[model samples]
Target: MTGFEGKTVVLTGAAGGIGRDLARAYAGRGAAVLLTDLSGEAGEALARELNEAGGSASFFPADLAQPEAAGLIMEAAVRTFGRIDILINNAGFGIWKPPLELSVDEWDAVLNVNLRGTFLCSREAAKVMKRQAQGGAIVNIASTRAAQSEPNSEAYAASKGGIVAITHALALSLGADRIRVNAISPGWIDNGKFGELRPEDHAQHPAGRVGRTADIARACFYLTDPDNDFVTGINLTVDGGMTRKMIYEE
Candidate 1:
């Protein structure tokens, strides 16, 4: 139960579908977490809910698209928790657009948040984790589109593809410092009622429903455990076998 006790995690996009789940899951497991998101109110409310439930969390609102936002959130987490042992690059943007239909600005925006944000957060986390006598872990949330993509997914697919590359590169770069890095690509996340969808949205996943926050959360917990010293530079696909299914089921 205390696998993560006393550990501090900095999670970006903490107000979004998967992000919110991650914040609660980590806090529930006794991790002190800093939740960063573009929505100040939502981030704060989520943190408040966790704290009220006996978990530890604080909101640090920041937009990953901004150049300074990633560093700012890292600094805030360290200031609030004394140190950060986990970094979840969970904030990202997905704009489905064909090559001709997609705008340059839109492409840039998506890449900046999805790709650049991951880079920025990893860089900052690497710096702090290096100082710790004990090392840390980093989990980057990508999409299943990186493997077998769909139409109008140029920007998003590219961003996620870049994520796998970065995971390998950073794993090699940070292994010397005892920091491990990995990525998870979630497919058809059936995040129920995110914004306005009904519970039926959960049926959208091939696993008889959409992906659960626990699905990804479990992976994150496994990869970050103190005993998990040998696992690194891996890209796990927790998409309910959707990506591997060749036939469309009824």
Candidate 2:
């Protein structure tokens, strides 16, 4: 937060959920935020709200599934803020059908948005960051399913797994340019409608509650901050000890 007073952050999936929280957190810390999402209406509203609240913010509507969209997103961000100091590749969705019932198009849809989108955005941002000579950071939003998953999540799991792999590969490729790349695998983050969760949900986690959007947002700040220069190429799992817990039927 200390180093972000005048920085610029380009965040995808900024219409709602974790992406929304990340936008707010970055703006609250004085970063000029360029928010992008498929839901243009919501994204623009959030941007207007943030600007009204005395934060620098703008919105660009994008469909990450399209290959060319990522480049345009980076272009818009640079045009609006002059440069991109951070890139959050968080625009993604999942399909919950059983593997047997899944269609080829469905699988492709998930991969296109989740995996290809991350690559496109990171590639473009890296190019810009290298030119800037000031270095930058990239945070890819993977999922706990990348390492461990339940039924009916084959496509989602594979996409997230790819995210972790690319994080390290990009880190190595971009380290020379001072662009750090990392992934955050969040577990059981309850981004449901308000009041839809119950006490058991909080009690089930070893950390005493399910994950929050702010939890991931804070981790992003830590990993991206220039002070933590040596912390690249790592997949930081932010699960509330759930992944470590062993379960059995009584």
Candidate 3:
């Protein structure tokens, strides 16, 4: 938080949910935030709100599934803020269907947005970070489904698992350049209605509650913090202990 002053953070899928909270958290901590998402209306509105409230912010509308999207985003961020210090790959969608029922188009869509997009963005940012004296951080937003999953979630699981693998791979490749890369696997984060929850929902986790956007946002900050330079290539699970619990069906 203290070190983020004047830093520039590029956050994808920042129009809503965890990405939106991340944009706010980084900006609130004194970072200039570049918010990108396919939803231009909402993304632009959030950028305006942040700027009006005295945070340096801008919105770049993009569909990360495209091959050129990532490069364009990084270029715009540099043009606006001069440099990129942190990159958060949070643009993704899930598809749940029986393996036999899933279509190739659906599978390709998820993979392109979730995995390929992350890779493209990280590659572009790393190139820029390598040229600078001060290196940077990249945090990929994976899901707990990568390690544990329910039926009919093959596409989502594969994409997230790829994220974990790519995180370590990038870390090893970029370490010499001082660019740290890591991944966060979140479980049961309620980005929907927060007030409409039952006691059983909170009781299901050993942490005694479901995850919030702030939980992931704080985790992002922790991984990207200059003080935690030694932490990289690790998949930090912010799942409230649910992934480690064993539950037997009644």
Among these predictions, the greatest lDDT belongs to 3
Report model 1's TM-score to 2 decimal places: 0.92
Model 2 agreement with the true structure over 1-250: per-residue lDDT tens digits: 4659879999999999999889999999999999999955899899998999999999998898889999999999999999999999999999999999999999999999999999999999988999987899999999999999899999999999999999999999999999999999999886755367788988878998888888998999999898898999999999999889898889
After TM-score superposition, the amount by which residue 19's alpha carbon in candidate 2 deviates from its true location, in angstroms, is: 0.5
Ranking of candidates on lDDT, top first: 3, 2, 1
lDDT of 3 at 221: 91
In Å, residue 101's CA in model 3 sits off its true spot by 1.3
lDDT of 3 by residue, 1-250 (tens): 5559979999999999999889989998999999999955899999999999899999999998899999999999999999999999999999999999999999999999999999999999998889878899999999999999899999999999999999999999999999999999999999977679898999999999999999998999999998899999999999999999999999
TM per model? 0.92, 0.97, 0.98
Candidate 1 weakest ten by summed lDDT = 193-202
The residue pairs found clashing in candidate 3 are none
Clashes of each: 1, 0, 0
Q: What is the lDDT of residue 185 in candidate 1?
A: 88
User: Candidates 2 and 3: which is better by lDDT?
Assistant: 3
Runs in model 3 deviating more than 4 A are none
Query: What does the lDDT read for residue 23 in candidate 2?
Result: 93
lDDT of 1: 0.88
For model 3, the run of ten residues with the poorest summed lDDT: 1-10
How far out, in Å, is residue 105 in model 2?
A: 1.1
- Worst window of 10 by summed lDDT in candidate 2: 188-197
Badly placed stretches (over 4 Å) of model 1 are 193-208, 248-250
